[model samples]
Each structure stands twice: as C-alpha cells, then as structure tokens.
Target: MSKAFTKEEDGTEKIRLDDLPQSTHPNLVTPSGLADLKARLAAARLELENLRARPEEIDSTMAIAVAERDIRFLESRISKAILIDPKDHSSGVVEFGATIDVVNEEDEQLTFRIVGEDEANPAQGLIAPYSPLGVALLGGETGGTVEWQKPSGVVELEIIAIRFE
Candidate 1:
C-alpha cells in the first residue's frame, strides 16, 4: 500500500468520538438526582483537565475522549433536569420520590423508592418511575394492593406505608 493512501502514519490525527445518545423520556429528577448529575459533570471536567495537563505521560487519547463524552452527557442531562422536591408532594398517595414499604403475596416485606432514571439502582431499592413496580405503585394509597408485571409473571404487592423525604 502507498503511504499517500494511508491516513495513520504519525498518528497525529485527533480522534473525535461520537456523542452519547440522549434518552427520549422526560428528564424528571429528584433533588438528590440533580445533585448527583452535577457532581458527575464536575468530575468529568476535572478528569479531562488532568488528562490534558499530563498528555505526555501516556497515550491518553481514549481517556480524554471518554471524559469529554461523559461531560457532554452529564451536561445535557443536567440542563434538561426537572427537579422535584419530594417534601412538596402530597403524602396521601405514592408518587415520584416516595419511599414505600410493601408486602408481597409471598408475605415478604420489601422497600423501594421511586426515583428518576439516572438515580435508579434497583439493587439498592431505588426504582425508576417507568419501571413495572413503580408504575403499579404510583398513585396507590397506603394499604392498597397493586399488581407488578415482572418478566417472570405478575406479582401482587400490598402497600403498607408511604413516605417522602
């Protein structure tokens, strides 16, 4: 192959990574979720700066690209965030940011907090509003039963308590 037809001789060409895709859902966020997004953006900015400052130390092209991409994603998410304080919400029914205690048909007690997509950590009992359980629990009053459509099957859960912080 001729060197004239090649574009990777000295590896001087700047690699432009593709932008991260944005979500189509509404950007609903609790107070804590918004704070987390801001913190992530700050960290990404710091990482990018550090990588640029010490570029000669290693091949940081990929690191810098990743950091820049994360910064873009976090900034976009923060910009579109609709902060909702749970304290301002009514306590009569389940809603976003509501912490609920439920008893399943198997008599197992479980707790979950309805949160935004960015703040969802199901393993930690935090669920997104669009999740099957969250969808079923939302608007449910305490002592009411809701059916959760899990991938395995439908499970009935009785809401024992509802609280907001």
Candidate 2:
C-alpha cells in the first residue's frame, strides 16, 4: 500500500480530500458576496489549523480533510470572482445585483435580487443571473412582461420595479 493510504498509529486511515466542482458560468459577485467568501475562507483555514494540531485525536483527520477541501474551494472562488457593485450599474436595467419586483400572471407580486450563482438563495429571494427567470428579466423595462419556460409550462411576469442598491 502507498504511504498515503497507510493507517496511522491510532488506526485512522489517511483521508483524501476531493476538489469541489467549479461552476461553468461566469464568476460575478457583489461586494458583499466577495466579503462573505473571504470570511468563509478564513474560517476554513482556522478550522483546518485546529484539526491538524490534534492529529492523534483520530476523528481530527477526517475533520482536517473536510476543512482542507473547503479552503481549496473558497480560494478558487475568491480568485475567480469579478466584483460588481449594483450601485455602480445603470439604473432601470436588470443587471447583476439589481433588486427587482415583479407581478405574475396570477397577480401575485414577488421580489428577487439578481446575484451571482454562488450567492443565490432562492428561498431568500436571491436569483442567479443565468437562471431562466433572471435571463428573461434582464434588459426588461418596468411594466414590461417577460416570459420564461418553467417546469410547469411558460410563465409570464411583469416587471413592476427595478432598483440598484
């Protein structure tokens, strides 16, 4: 067996960490999103250091491997990030970092912030720029209707407002 796979004196096998898959879409990030990524990277590094300092603890090896994997992923994201401030973008356009309010065909109103893929949280009303709805909303003027194909069928949304903050 290779030394890498060998068991340690405490009978814990050396864990191998795998790199996370990178997103193919462009890495556009808001200023706050970039800050979040940097903070996560710092926390991951600190966790990894703590895990390594207690190598003989048996469970620490797996924890260390996980932390290392997170660090690698965060580092990649930070390096590839392209910061874009919503305040700097032109008003009334659905560019990245724009918060938009829309009304659906059913007269239900919804709000979403167009953000980078990494920062997207659908439940939080944050949508990725490459999403079907996001793409349709881009360049759409207020009071204009945009249609997108959804799993249920085609859905239409009328842009009620656009704001960059």
Candidate 3:
C-alpha cells in the first residue's frame, strides 16, 4: 500500500502559534489598572492549567495554543505595568489618572478619566493618556482651553474641573 493510505502517528506534525505582539509605548498604569492586569494574568494561568490537565476533553492542539498565547500575553503585560497612584500626582493639574470635566464649544458637558491604554474604554469615559483628547487635556488647569484635533475638525474643550481619584 502507498504511504498516503497509511495512518500517520499523532505526533507526526507540529503546529506553531505565534506570540502576540507587545506595545512599544511605556506601560503606564493606574493602581487599579495594575491590579486588573495581575488578575487577568492569574486567570490566564488558571485556564492554561485546566486546558493542560484535560487535553482529552477537547481539541487539545487548538485549545492549548489559545491558552498558551493568552498566558504569554497577560504575563508580558503584567510584567511591564508601571503603577501610578492618582493621589500621588499633582492635585490641580490634569495628569495621568486625573478625572476631568470639560465643556465643548456647543456647551455639551463631558467627563473623562485618563487611564492606561489597557484600561481605556472610551464609551465609559475612560481614555488613554496618549489619546487625542487626553493629550489635549493633560497639563491643563481649571479654566484653561485646549483644542483637540479630531479627524472631523478641531474642537475646543474648556477645562471645568479636574480631580484625582
């Protein structure tokens, strides 16, 4: 019989999965952000252990690949986290971990909390410190005006208040 007709051994082929890329920017994180990263890393490690212990319960190769990738990514992120306590920063200036209240030219009030990239959720008002609005707001004091260059156009935001958590 031709070799093609024979059953191949289980370990005959190997599958390689590439690691997730790490961000080039500094891993600036709030105290909560660092805690969240650590928690996620712990969860990933638990999941990896579970996957390895029960390889016979599922598609072991693909499942193991995903779990391992998550572990590596979370571990790297946790390792790179630089925790910055909001209370330790300047009280009056808009800096990282500062909660800011601003008003646009249209008189619409908005609030944003500057946080780490990993903890940024724009819809919920959490913004990355390097984001356009965050950059414009940083270093600003109460009653200051900043022009944010958005893709639509430049929008001016007036600083109403700034507080640290």
RMSD of each: 4.6, 3.2, 5.6
Assess candidate 1 and give its TM-score to the true structure. 0.90
TM-score winner, 1 or 2: 1
lDDT for each candidate structure? 0.87, 0.87, 0.84
User: For residues 34-130, could you state the per-residue lDDT of candidate 3 as single tens digits?
Assistant: 8888888888888878877885764765666677777888788888888889998766789999999999999999999999999999999999988
Clashing pairs for predicted structure model 3, backbone only: none
- Taking the tens digit of each residue's C-alpha lDDT, what string does model 2 give over 37-151? 9999999999888888887886887777678778889999999999999999877768889999999989999999999888899899998999988898888888888997798
Better of 1 and 3 by lDDT: 1
lDDT of 1 by residue, 12-55 (tens): 44455677888888888999999999999988999999998986
Which window of ten consecutive residues has the lowest lDDT sum in model 1? 1-10
What is the lDDT, from 0 to 100, of the residue 57 in candidate 2? Answer: 88
* Quality of model 2 by C-alpha lDDT: 0.87
The prediction achieving the highest TM-score against the true structure is 1
Q: Evaluate model 3: give its lDDT.
A: 0.84
Worst 10 residues of 3 by lDDT: 1-10
